[model samples]
Target: MSSTFSLKYMSRRVSCAFNLLQVCLVVAVLALLVTASPLFAENALNGAENTAEAETEAGVAAAEVIQAPALAAIAPAPAADEPLSPRMRAALGYVAQRYRVSADALRPIFHAVQSTSQELSLDPLLIVAVIGVESRFNPFSQSVMGAQGLMQVIPRFHKDKLPANAGKAPLLDPVTNVRVGSLALEEAIRRNGGLMEGLQQFAGATRDEDQTYATKVLSEKQRLEDAANRRLGRG
Candidate 1:
């Protein structure tokens, strides 16, 4: 056989082997992706669990923050997607999980809280904590005291605070409820001369003297912050 023909055959064999190797590598990669996809999905779906360690840290951080006299010193929650900070992501993840609600559903409310907190010089987490305590984020929640919506603002008492038109319908709207509820909370804090006093008045539990309502609200806010700090690995 000619040396040329022999060399050509040898070259063809190497080329074929290389092509087969490439095909095998591609197949292996595809198999890996297929097998690992569910884990990725679960990780995405269970993002709440990813921040569990933050809960404890969040508790301590939250406690410190609530006692600080001004919630505005704490980081502000994000209202927009484009500029979401790590803390905002953690807050959303934690609250969504804590309240047993979807991130999508929680977002607009968070945005409203952000806007209202900014407007009122109040901490956004405090508003979120209020929502958690009053309604667990249920936009349609109503109380026996005639309180309605996420913030549990009784329409009759807070008519002036409700969105224009003097109706209870606006109170049921999650965004509107958060905005108005936060305003109410801000006013309560102002009238009572402090955060604790304001919270007591807001809950109409001023006579209790134990300040249970304020403590619960502050604790809830602290948990959110701890979770956020933990998620950021600050915990």
Candidate 2:
């Protein structure tokens, strides 16, 4: 009986040891699975973060490219035409106001001056200066010396140079005055060689000192230009 009891006790001790060993092995395997799961989760999160960063950078690049073309399209273009002449533009305004007419009313006179000046190879400003001085753009102005129209043309001179009945009509008619004045100015320019000498020639015998007449006419031209600038609010 004692021997049988010892054998049974030994067998029971062996069975308990084996069960404990099995529990320890299962615990070790569960610990390994938990640690490896965390590593895999961290790697997946890092990959997702990298992908999101790349997408954000791509969006910023796309925005820059889109805005580049849009900004270029909206940019202002440069002006491509010539600017107007201040002197000529101011002269036109003066002519409009002094004549009490619209700018269009003097288009013919402007064209005549331009055409005649070109044909005579004269400065249009010189012609305008003479017109401003002689009559203040008044077509019918007559001098005490019987000089008629804007040019203060002498009737006898017109008879010699112009067609018949040239001086019989009203002296202040703008078209007739411009025609006669242009012709006389052309003749004066021919005799004098250039604008300066022609101006001197036009002033001859008109004043006690020849330079005095030229000075007066030039001064008048300046006044007209000033008046025009004032009206245009450029003064």
Candidate 3:
């Protein structure tokens, strides 16, 4: 073979080999990138899951804050009977009869009173008495002073006591009204340092003559207590 031909032939072979090597390198890089794609996607998914978990924890923390006060107010159960014993049933019956309300209507809302009493460390009977004096178990009752609902709580004054889910429903809603009213009474009692004083404050009675309102409430409370005792055979 001629030298020029041999040299040219060898150069062409080398060029072909270099081209093949380049193709192989490009294929290898593409394969590596494809292999890494799944890892990248997995990392993104894990990050999203972490964010969701963090949000869930934050929601739970907020719920705890809203619920802690009510939970902490619960007292130990009575040893002789459940919190709403036969005595309480009698009281409910008496109130229902005296107020001309349906016993079924009174029965359903006893849960709210019990829950409030537990949360506020107050007596359910006292709450019932207050309701009797305030609205006579009328959920739709409204006062001339803008006081509304079964407990006649002024909505604007106690808006902070409303539950988160309580939308634009009128303050006359029995459940919402009772909850806020009970909280207001709890605050009044705490502020005045005595039940009678609290009742006076709740009634907006600042003067000595204003005590009549408190006296009425106390009288109602006694009547309900008597009724409950009678039912339990303790009268």
Candidate 4:
């Protein structure tokens, strides 16, 4: 009886030891799985965050590209018939007032001056100065010294130098006078080497004449420009 009891007790002890070993193995595997699961979850979260940031950057880039062409297309280009400079407009107004004529009346004269000046390589300001000094822009003016029209061109000079149309017309016609005056100014510039020098040399005999003449004509130009500015409500 004693021998049988010993064998049974030994077998029960061995069974308990085997069950403890099995429990220890299962605990170790559970710990390893817990640690690795956290690493996997962190990697997935990081990937999702990187994807969201990339998408945001792409959206901003797309918005900028879409807006660029729209802004450029909506912008207005400058017009071909932009208004004249303030000084030029003022000069026109002064001529109109002094001549007792409408601003429209002087447009043709202004155009003629511009055209002729370009053709002759002369300054339109110099021609304007000569007209102001010679006849105060009065196309009907005649001098006792035989100087006639806006630039006070001598009839003899016109007959000798000008074309037949110039000789046949009355010296007081504004277009004819301006045409003749422009030609004379071109000749003067050629003879004296420049517009300012020609004016100085030609007006040498009169009182403080060259500077005075330039100042007066420039002043007239300014006045005309100022008047035009007022008319246009441009200040």
Candidate 5:
């Protein structure tokens, strides 16, 4: 009986050792899974972020592709009856600021200048320069010698050059003045055979002291040309 009891106690001790070993193995496996959990979670988060970034980039590219043609279609076209180009407007503003002239008053006259220059086959800057020197754009200006208006055209001498439709427009009128003066200048150019000589004759500068008149007009013309060029973005 003593032998049987000792055998039983030994068997029970071996069973308890086995159960402890199994418990230790399970705890070790659980620890290993816990250690790898953060790594797996980090990898999943990184993958998700990369996918989101790619989607955002694709969305931006698609938006740009969709918007491109719409933006082009909405671009403004040049109008048929637009009175002034941006460059022309800039040129006018520059001249008006530099000369202290009323842009409102002088603006409409530029159209006339352009048309008249084309009709007369003359450089528009030359006429504008002469107007600057003659009356500083003052429509009511009159000289002691009876020269009147912006270009100071002498009414008595240039009466024949007046437009037939002028009717009773005075020499002080801007349109009639410029028309008559341009015609007179054209005739003077024809008679003298050159621009400088024609300008001198137009000024009636017989004395040597008046030699600077043509030079001043030409200088102003050069300034205006440069202003126009700058406005056109060619300077």
Candidate 6:
């Protein structure tokens, strides 16, 4: 039997066995990072009004994506007509506030995730969570393991999967990075036969029996869910 280990939405599932306490710890660290930079809150507030319009345009700005495969899908993407759902909007806001980036600037990233969701059956929140765990939203981040861009994908391992026209340093491009990373994530889950193992493979930590990397990714995802629910009055 093939192990179908997709990282489905945690809010609705009884699987994965994610540790909420660990999630809370990550959130606390995130909070401390924001607190250390008070201007982040101020910047988020100042950019609030612009978010609506920018987000509208941002949805239109998200480039196209190619699919490697869908990992049994994740969070439901809102209706095609309403790409930016309340949950998605809430997620964008939280990321902007936490990362000290303007909401207007994050619109494109959300849009990209949304677009990818439509194709690859992954949730924007999950992708957002992975990005946080991988690189804290830093498009230029490069791990000591040779992972690069916001998704921390190792280019050498996935150059063939990249867009043909993507020039040198393609992984550094946020849009391209997200697209390839999502595909890579799907492939990993599909190959590993389950979410836990897939995430372990993605993190290059298959031997970690405690599943720390998967736990961290899920924790970040839970945080996104909480933020979305709170913003949507569904908490």
Give the range where candidate 2 is weakest over 10 consecutive residues by summed lDDT: 75-84
Least well predicted 10-residue stretch by lDDT in candidate 3:
75-84
lDDT against the true structure, per candidate, is 0.84, 0.70, 0.83, 0.69, 0.80, 0.82
Q: Cα lDDT for residue 94, model 2?
A: 77
Model 4 regions more than 4 Å off = 1-90, 158-160, 167-169, 201-235
Candidates in order, TM-scores: namely 0.64, 0.49, 0.63, 0.50, 0.60, 0.64
RMSD to native, candidate 2: 19.5
Q: Of the candidates shown, which would achieve the greatest lDDT relative to the real structure?
A: 1
| TM-score, cand. 1 | 0.64
What does candidate 1's lDDT look like per residue over 28-108, in tens digits?
999999999999999987786757767868988989888776665543344565444566668999988877889977877
* lDDT string, candidate 5, 118-180, tens digits: 789988778888998999888899889888888998888877787776665467767667777
Report clashes for each candidate as comma-separated counts.
Answer: 2, 3, 0, 9, 0, 2
The lDDT ranking, best first, is 1, 3, 6, 5, 2, 4
Compute the lDDT of residue 44 as modeled in candidate 5.
Answer: 96
Better of 2 and 6 by TM-score: 6
Candidate 1, lDDT over the whole model: 0.84
Residue range 35-95, candidate 3, lDDT tens digits = 9989999999999999999999999999999999888776322222234557667888888
Clashing pairs in 5: none
For residues 122-143, write the lDDT of model 4, one tens digit per residue.
Answer: 6565676677777776778887
The best-first sequence of candidates by TM-score reads: 6, 1, 3, 5, 4, 2
* lDDT score of residue 219 within candidate 2: 76
CA error at residue 3 for candidate 5, angstroms: 99
Could you give candidate 2's per-residue lDDT for residues 1-235 as a string of tens digits? Answer: 9999999999999999999999999999999989899898999999999999999999999999989999988653322243335656677777777667576655555665666666777666667778777776666677888887667777666555565655456345555566667778788768877655666677554345456666776776677667657867878
